[model samples]
Target chain A: MIKVLFFAQIRDQLATSELRMPSSENHNIEMLLSNLKARDSHWQTVLSKTNLLVAVNQTISNENSALQSGDEVAFFPPVTGG
Target chain B: MIKVQTTDFNLQAEHDKLREKSSVGAVVTFSGLVRDINQGKEVSSLTLEHYPGMTEKSLTKIVEQAKSRWNIIDCTVIHRIGELKLSDQIVFVGIASLHRQDAFAACEFIMDYLKTEAPFWKKESTTDNESYWVDAREGDLKALNKWSK
Candidate 1:
């Protein structure tokens, strides 16, 4: 399974801190994102934000990054801490 | 040392920790405080949230980058999470080096990178009883460009 997490405003908006999904080695971030966006209109709107940030396995990653089973993925807003 | 905690930290203690080496000649520190006002709104308090594993990894990477670019002898970073009131300390960055220039530059560089690279977010509650997540500033992104060039 792939562990997906959300934080900050995205978490507040989605009301989900985390979820687990069955994963395949063929799955990449973009495909996972599209699968998430397909859940509902609210998910679609929130996940579709242009500035949304993603990380794979605790490192900053882009949508093109590949995923594997048991990998951890996170989606959050741009950082604002000092 | 890098730490993310909910409790407040001592500035003098952090400074002393970074300046432990006898060869260190200068120690520079920067602390961020929760402001009473932001963007014309009267902020009453701030709540910080971070990804547990990722926050540490990102902060370590930033500190490593600073060490590589400067003659840093030692350093300490402490970032406070959870709710914080006005005047409360939010973050601290301290760098020690053999010269003042390296300590100062590395201190600022770590802060600049931390603002954009670390996995932290702030939610501000105003005096009017409204709360909202602060948006990331475009200027913060631009801050990184200066270091690259």
Candidate 2:
């Protein structure tokens, strides 16, 4: 299983902080997000936003980044703090 | 030194600590405060949230980058989280070096990187009880880009 984290506006919008999901074959960030988007319309709207930021294992990541078992993934809005 | 704390910090104490090195000849400090207004909204307070482990890691990386790029003797960064009212101190960056130019440049670079790279989010509460998350400004990204060149 992989740990999925959310923060800031995305956390509020989805009303979730963290969850765990099973690792899948050929899993990558894009597949994880699309799987999440299929959960509901609200999730689709939030995950589909073009500006959403993602991190894999606490480092900035893109949709092309591959995922693995026990890897942590995070999603958040653009940072606005100094 | 890097600290992300809920309590307020003492600027003089932080400065004194940074300037303790005998080789240090110039010290530069910058503080950001919560303002009464933002984007035409009358802000009453700001709430800051940060990803715990990730925030520490990012801040450490930023400090390391500054040290690598400048001849800095010592440096300190303190960022306050949680509820902060108007005029409250939000962040502090202090750098001590052999020359003023290095201190100034490193301080600015750290701040610019912190604005975009750090995992911190701020929500502003208005006088009318309305609240909204602040959006990232394009100017901040451009500011960070300047350091890369």
Residue B73, model 2: lDDT of 93
Query: Residue B24: error of model 2 in Å?
Result: 0.5
TM-score each candidate: 0.98, 0.97
Q: lDDT tens string, model 2, B1-149? A: 89999999888998999989799999999999999989899999999999888888899999999999999999898988999999999999999999999999999999999999999999999999999999999999999777878
lDDT of 2 by residue, A1-82 (tens): 8899999999999999999888974299989998899889999999999899999988889999999999999999998877
In candidate 1, what are the lDDT values of residues A6-81, reduced to their tens digit?
A: 9999999999999998796339999999999989999999999999999999999998999999899999999988
Docking level of model 2 = high
DockQ of 1: 0.91
